[model samples]
Target: MTTIDKAPTVQSQRAGTGTRGTRILGTLTIVSMVWLIAFGLGFSPADRDQQEAVRIMYVHVPTIWIAYLAFVVTAVASGFYLFKKSLGWDRLAGASAEVGTVFVALTLIVGALWGRLTWGVFWQWDARLTTTALLFVTYVGYLAVRRLGGTHEQRARRSAVIGLLAVLLIPLVHWSVRLWRSLHQEATVLDPDGDIDMDGLMLFSLFVGVIAFTLFYVWLMLHRTRVMAMEDMMEDRGLDEALASRRREAAMPDSEEN
Candidate 1:
């Protein structure tokens, strides 16, 4: 396992940070989530074409947005770890990737629901859908690699490299609709021509959903990182105890006489 001399310090610092900020963010995220649900489910007018199905967009789009953000953060952290060889960066990268996997999985589920409703099919091999699925699987593989048995540095280095390489798929996923004739629509709010093709209320609801999910990701990352740090500390203590026992045995006199 990768060892950090300051694992205890890192854990304590994160606990302190999580105390005040997590509470505030958690509360605010709940508030935003409530408003988003109300706006998406009741206030926002249904789409002329898809009607009730369009509401899924509020959930589906924001989740993918947050998932993308999570992967980007992971990649950046991994890059820093490579450059500075900081265990903290490696832990952050791993934590972010795990959270990103959850969000991306949710993204795929919600997207499938939306597709079934809007397109009369649960899935399609379109450019955007395929690339998004690929992105999800890639990060999932990254997480799996992190769990493999190895020294902390070995696992961290391998996972960090995978994390950075996986981000290359992000652009492909984002621009897949444009790059090919995908059933998925190209950017609506982020249209290159600076046009939003949705109602004002719907747009606001989408924004709230984005903020809520983003805050949720932040909370998840903080909690998950703390958990990883504690695990690392436990692993370190186990190794120390085992080594001490070995040293004690070596110091003991041989009992064989005769």
Candidate 2:
């Protein structure tokens, strides 16, 4: 297989740079998260029933939002790869898939913690739990396929196709509780009968947490892409392979020299 001799320049608008705007956005994210985490920990009161256990929301809700955002990234990257076939898109897709897995795992952990506190059980295999678990497993498979399957482009193309199809789970998760009544609650954002009833500071903190976690997600994806690119560079340039080939050639006496 022919490897690309040079590293591809990764450029995506979602990727932040050293520009002042990016710096300011990053700084704002840090400030917001610091305040949100602090406020959620200290200022926010425990739920009337669940008490301190409800406090887990500070960590849980933000992580779930990040997971959703990650799926969005995966969908976009897969679509881009299908249309443009940019190696960058494939790299981003693969990176996002890994990150998404982390967040999905977090979601499961936090959800179980909350379930234990409120329902007095560690887990219940409810509709929400089962569907979300299925979603996580599906993407984990997506990542494994790329790692264990064919060469770079081939694996990427295959993963992209799988990713696009796997994304159907997102909508299913959103509707699972509606389709089947369960212990897990429906989304607070769009309840049909009433508006979201979050307390003032709590709501503000939650929104800020979303922003903070999304920024964190972007930071992770960029770092992941950079690592993948460096690996690609080493494989493509074949510096060691070329050296080994040269050594092999040297071991044989040249007929002309003789």
Candidate 3:
């Protein structure tokens, strides 16, 4: 028998292949994250001076890096969407921005915790922190803008512009410590002399954190993009049904009432 509930079932099946890939990647991400945390906590060497407090860098630095990476993907996707007027590009930008916002919040929270342990405060108006905060707020606003009601093209065009413009803060956040004297320390991994000023274990653990978080972000973006596509598909189905109903009504002859 025919069923009224078949449309979404078909949509879900269409997404099955990609979802399976995401599931496999998500499993690998979980395993890598566990290894990263274990190595950071137990194997990584403590700093010469910071002692136990240094471990936070494994999470703090990597999360902030991923946040930057996410937004950069969003900006590039936005640019491509603008150039091509493609829905695929718009979906990619939206997915990246959503994941980026979560990572930015994590960066702030972890940074605050690390600061309390090392800098003797949970919050500060340091240049890097302030700029990072601004970046977070900007992307949050970008996500909110996406939720505003509009036609697909209208929403995509507006969000693509926002995605491009919001990422301008990334460089400012990255170089804020260098640009202005602040309590935040300068870049460690990107030293001017190309010398990494850290123990081998610490560096290795940092690398692991970066890889793990980046994989997690990719898994998240895949899932988010799929969900967004499904939403759009459902909306399209609803519009199609509404238009077909209107057409049927228009085609009906007026009742033979004098």
Candidate 4:
């Protein structure tokens, strides 16, 4: 009797950036967000001055905080990339910058809504607003610099420089209210005098917002960095294939002449 050859089973890989850790993190993020919504909207009492409009602070504050954190991470990672000449650090810097840009936009939008309610105008020439807008624009330019065409090293070097320089705006933006006579309120949670201006429950809700957003940031960074890595791999592979194709074509002309 003739034995038939057995076909080997090929394991199929799942597509997408998620992993077991990210899934667990995503679950935690979702749960924390639900709690944040409950505490921020339902449980926390309205501000005596701003009334229901104070609810926006729960989102507005955390978003700006995360944006600042993301920029700092980008600056640190960019520094490491410059020192170590490592692509991993470069990928991290790019991912963080992208995520930070989104958070900055969110912060501006939420702040505008809060401003409209409290300051009686959606837009203002306040120092805090101007500096925040400048911060957002600077990062947007940093991202554009990253996309400028060149080798990976070229892209990383230029972008890293911009990343390092762009973070200088954060301190200026943070202190703009203090440094100038402005309509923007001083920091309540991070009061310079160490006095907590918010109620107990309100403070707790703000903390919850911070925690939820931080978790979300980690989850997003995980997915984004993985995606960036995959993109680089694809780009390198395509370049190699194109070079091989060129070699084959160059040899074909000689073979045809022969």
Cα RMSD to the true fold for all candidates: 6.6, 7.1, 7.4, 9.2
**Can you give the lDDT of residue 89 in candidate 4?**
81
Q: Name the regions of candidate 1 deviating beyond 4 angstroms.
A: 1-18, 169-196, 239-258
Best by lDDT: 4
Q: Candidate 2 residues 1-258, lDDT tens each?
A: 013112344433444224454466668778877877787788877665567766677778888778878877888989898898877788888888899899999989988877776676677655667677878988898888788755678977998998898877667775865466544554432221122576777676667677788888876676677667656655666687689878888888695487
* lDDT tens readout by residue for model 4, 1-258: 001111112232566677677899999999999999999999999887778988988898899899989988899999998999877788889988899999999989988887788777787755666777888888999999999978888988999998988777667666864466445445432211122577899899999999999999999988888777767766767688789889999877867667
Number of the predicted model whose TM-score against the real structure is largest: 4
How much lDDT does candidate 2 score? 0.72
Error of 4 at 107 (Å): 0.8
Q: Candidate 4 overall Cα lDDT vs. reference? A: 0.81
User: What lDDT score goes with residue 141 in model 2?
Assistant: 86
Clashes of 2: 0
Candidate 1, residue 142: CA error in Å?
0.7
| Candidate 1 residue lDDT tens string, 1-258 | 232222346325444325566688889889888988899899999887778878888888888888878888899999999999977888989988888888889988988887787667787766667787888888889989999978889988999998887777567666864566545554432211122576899888888888888888887777677678778766868788789878887787584342
Q: Show the lowest summed lDDT stretch of 10 residues, model 1.
A: 186-195
Q: List TM-scores for all candidates, in order.
A: 0.79, 0.75, 0.79, 0.80
lDDT of each: 0.78, 0.72, 0.78, 0.81
